[model samples]
Target: MQHEAKAARTVKEDRTDYLTEERYGHTAAHATMALTGTEWGVTTWNTRPRSVGRVTVCASNGPFAFQESISPVEARLIAQALLMAADDAEKAIDAAYVQDEVTA
Candidate 1:
C-alpha cells in the first residue's frame, strides 16, 4: 500500500498527461517531493503521431519517476526543514499567547 499510493500520486498526471513531451521524450525532467509523506512512485511515457512526418512537442512529459528509497542525507534535510517549520509554528503560538495576555 505504501508503494502503491506513492506511485499513483508522484507523477503529476494532469488532463493532458498523455500528450506531454515527457511522454515522447522532449522536455527536461524533474520531480516534486512526495506530498503525502511518501516519496515512492514511477512516471510513465508514450509517443504518438499527429500527422505524417510531423512532430509535436508535449509539455506533459515526465516525473513518471519517484524516489524509491530515501537517502539518509535527504531524510536528514527533510527532517531539518520540518523542524525549522515547526519552530516557526511554535513562535507563532507564542505570539498568540502574548497577544492574549495583552488583551487580558
Candidate 2:
C-alpha cells in the first residue's frame, strides 16, 4: 500500500535528518558512555535524516575520562572520540593486557 511505502521512506529519512529530542537523549547517552570508555557498541537513532549521532571513545587505561569547563562542541567530540580511541586503540598497545582480562 502507498501508506506502507511512505512509512518506510520516513524511516529511511530519519537516519540523516536532525534527530528529535528523544533521539538527542540517546545520542547524548551513547556519546557520554563511549567517551567514558565502556565499550565499542555504538548505535544509531532517528533513522530519518541519517544522524551518526556520536562516537564514544574511551581512554587507554579504561578508567573513564573527565573534563572540566568545556566550551565548543568540537572539544566535546574530541574528548569523546579520544577517550574511545584510546580504549579501542589499546589492543595495539597491550595485547596481553586485554587477553589477561576476561568479560562475563
Candidate 3:
C-alpha cells in the first residue's frame, strides 16, 4: 500500500511537470508567431496554486483579451472549435486566392 501511494505521487508530479512544460512551450511559440501577425495566442496557467487553470486568449496586435477558467472537458471543446475555425479560415483564403488567379 505504501509503495502504491508513492507511485501515485510520482505519477501526479510527472503529470504536473508535463503540463508546465507544455504551457511554457505554447507561450514561447505564441511570442514568435505574434510577430508575423498571423496567430492569436492562448496561454494556460494555474489560477489557484495546483487546483485551477485559466486559459487566456488574446490578440497579437491589439489589447483584446478573453480569459476563462476551464475544466478538461471545456478545454477539449475549445480546442475543437478553434480547429474548425482555422479550417474555415484556410478555405476562405484559398478561395480568394483562386479567384484572384482567375481574374489576373
Candidate 4:
C-alpha cells in the first residue's frame, strides 16, 4: 500500500441568492406600534444535498435587532403579504389625499 498527498478541497458549498442593499427590508408601522425606520438585511443561501434554501432577516441599524431563519417558501409568502399590505397602504394614502383636496 502507498500513501499520496492530495490538495485540500471544499466539501460543502453555499450559494448565496440575495446579498444586496436593495433586497433589504424595512420596518413597518402597526396598529399599536410606530415605525422605527429600521433597515433589515435579507440574506438567502442554498446548500447542496443538505437542506432547502434558507432566508435570514436581520436589522441593519438598531439596538433591537432580530434574525430569523426560514425556508424559501415561507419567505415568498412573507414577500407576497408585504406587497399586498403596501398596496393597501398606498390606496389609503391616495384616498386621504383626495379627501384633503376636496376639503381644501
Q: What shift in Å separates residue 30 of candidate 1 from its native position after superposition?
A: 30
Candidate 2 residue 56 C-alpha distance from true site, Å = 22
What lDDT does model 1 reach? Answer: 0.39
Model 3, 4: alpha-carbon shift in Å?
Answer: 42
Runs with alpha carbons beyond 4 Å of true place in candidate 1: 1-68
Summarize candidate 3's per-residue lDDT along 40-103 as a digit string, tens digits.
Answer: 4444444446544644444444554444556667768888998999999999999999999999
Best by lDDT: 4
lDDT by residue for model 1 over 1-104, one digit each (tens)? 12211112223432122121222333313322445332222223223232322222222224533233334465467659989999999999999999999999
Question: Model-by-model lDDT, in order?
Answer: 0.39, 0.36, 0.47, 0.55
Point out the higher-scoring one by lDDT: 1 or 3: 3
Show where candidate 4 strays beyond 4 Å. Answer: 1-19, 22-37, 46-52
Error of 4 at 61 (Å): 4.2
lDDT, ranked from best to worst: 4, 3, 1, 2
RMSD of 4: 15.5
Better of 3 and 4 by TM-score: 4
Query: For candidate 4, lDDT tens digit of each residue in 8-81?
Result: 22222564423232112432211111265555455555565444467666654457767787887898999999
All candidates in order of TM-score, best leading: 4, 3, 1, 2
Clashes of each: 10, 19, 0, 0
Sequence-dependent TM-score of model 3 = 0.47
Better of 2 and 4 by TM-score: 4
Clashing pairs in 1: 20-58, 20-60, 20-61, 21-58, 21-59, 22-61, 23-61, 42-64, 43-64, 43-65
